[model samples]
Target chain A: MERGGVTVRVLGIDPGLTRCGIGVVEGIVGRPLTLVDVNVLRTSASVPIAQRLVTIERGIDAWLDEYSPDAVAVERVFARSDSSTIMGTAQASGIALVAAARRGLPVATYTPSEVKAAVSGSGRADKAQVGAMVTRILRLDAPPKPADAADALALAVTHVWRGGARARIDAAVAAGRTP
Target chain B: MERGGVTVRVLGIDPGLTRCGIGVVEGIVGRPLTLVDVNVLRTSASVPIAQRLVTIERGIDAWLDEYSPDAVAVERVFARSDSSTIMGTAQASGIALVAAARRGLPVATYTPSEVKAAVSGSGRADKAQVGAMVTRILRLDAPPKPADAADALALAVTHVWRGGARARIDAAVAAGRTP
Candidate 1:
């Protein structure tokens, strides 16, 4: 799937205390995206919260150093009825934002539905559908193992397709021109 | 308030996105506590969440470098009906944990009730009562401005009283001895 030029690389993160999924994708809008890497960072439940956060920070830093993506996208955490789970997720997401911002990388956040809609054209798409779309788009023989990993790849694809177009429009507007 | 010979310095943090309160206190339990410092770090709501977190990290790092506290105490964030406020608070608290853990400082978390009980001898103490107790305990001319600052001071006092005792107990147990 090829279109215009201006290739952009994006690192997307699905933050969690137990398993933080990270994926990198490279491509321009409307083009077949290449999966640079995909992995999940895990921290044990027995570990102290402070140490768990440090582990996530180190993992994100390593990915940033290795991939050096143009932008970072993190799943926006929402408060749920389960306060404990939401707290950990929100905290983990915060570390992702801090890591990307520390390196002066543009950071964007997308809701789960946003990523689902961008990939499958349906905000209400289920996980299996989203994963199927991601596998098809990346031309992978199989979907990424673990739901978090596939979710992260979906986030990167969403950003590359939506964020890329938004960035272009913003640049054109700043330059006093019409896109 | 001088029952013990050991004097431990503690830096307590009340984390929030709009205003994070930081305070340092030095003294042994049952003795008059000295307020080393107390201040609030403020970030504008207009700022992006990622940049706001960076601002907090820098502020905490500066405090850690300046005080060299033996330990850190952070107020535990609780989930409330106000999901948005809690999300920011949880994120900010994560930064505090990371900054202290990175420095290898022992970190403890205390709930609001614990802080209030430690200072006012009542877990259900109101804000004004807690502030008055903090002012009187520290022998300050006035209560710390803004509730966050006073809350931070209370957290430090709580750690100095409870955490110090717990550490001694753990050490004694590790040594197979009695305190």
Candidate 2:
């Protein structure tokens, strides 16, 4: 639909300080077709934890700039035991949003459970299951490594299918309604 | 000094809820040169904020994979106005640390004052002064768009100089030991 029938691209981000996973998918909703890029970003502890987050942010920005995504989808936070860990999670998420917004791109966010449900058909889907589903869905030659990458792909797909009024539809489906 | 003579690459992060600024620099402490990347990450009010954090974390991870930074650095939290904001900041910081540690990277931290002095030659430097100095020192043609990106770069360069025992050195410097 955009620029002579090039399918709109959706960039999915799986946030974290050390290992951030990103997946780029092409196509439209109700049929998220292919996974273009699946990769993990890494950092060394010697640089300081906060620095690593910035390092990750820079990488994501570069990716965004290169691709010019139509929309961005990210996975939301999950509960963790440590207060410090949660703060890092929130900060990373903020960075991703700013990156997309600065480019005047719309953004969507999905919860861990919701992403799991959409991809795995179960809210409690584990990392491995989600990875398998992502691989199968994308028809990749190999499963994405570093777990987070697969999760990122799922978030992007979830946003396309289930974000916005799709949530309402899903809720209705749960209630056994067609509308 | 690297096997491939690849300039030592370090990624610095400033993790925040409202924004996370990230920067990457290559070279050793005193001879630091090149700014590979600088960017801001963002999210929104509508999405459950917690889930947003996770997406940020994953995004950072993907960046790390692409860049393969030698080390990661992050800014230390100083103070904030709101209690909820502080809680969120703390949680985000934790996630940043988790990313670094999970990757077996030795994480480091630098306080705001330390980062300011490193870049501006003033411990209590303001945002503009710090931003200006970062642009000057890094030879950036344009002032980094968002304040957070500049701050993240400062944190990274600071970590390069005095992240480990630099605090003690800074205190000594403050005592007029060295100019």
Instruction: Identify the leading candidate in terms of lDDT.
Output: 1
- Chain A TM-scores, per candidate, are 0.91, 0.82
By TM-score, the best candidate is 1
Residue-by-residue lDDT tens digits, candidate 2, A54-121:
67778888889887778888766644424556555555666676567656576777888889999889
What number of clashing residue pairs does each candidate have, in the order they appear? 3, 67
Please write out the lDDT profile of model 1 over residues A16-36, one tens digit for every residue.
999999999999776689999
Which stretches in model 2 have alpha-carbon errors above 4 Å?
A: A1-6, A78-84, A164-179, B1-87, B90-179
Whole-model alpha-carbon lDDT for candidate 2: 0.72
Tens-digit per-residue lDDT, B12-87, candidate 2: 8887666878787776656746788888776664444445566557666766777777777877663442454664
Residue range with the least summed lDDT across 10 consecutive positions in model 1 chain A: A165-174
**Per-residue lDDT value at A24 in model 2:** 86
Candidate 1 residue-pair clash tally: 3
Give candidate 2's error at residue B155 in angstroms: 15
* Model 1 whole-model lDDT (C-alpha atoms): 0.90
| Residue A50 CA displacement from its true place in model 2, Å | 3.6
Provide the TM-score of the second chain in candidate 2: 0.83
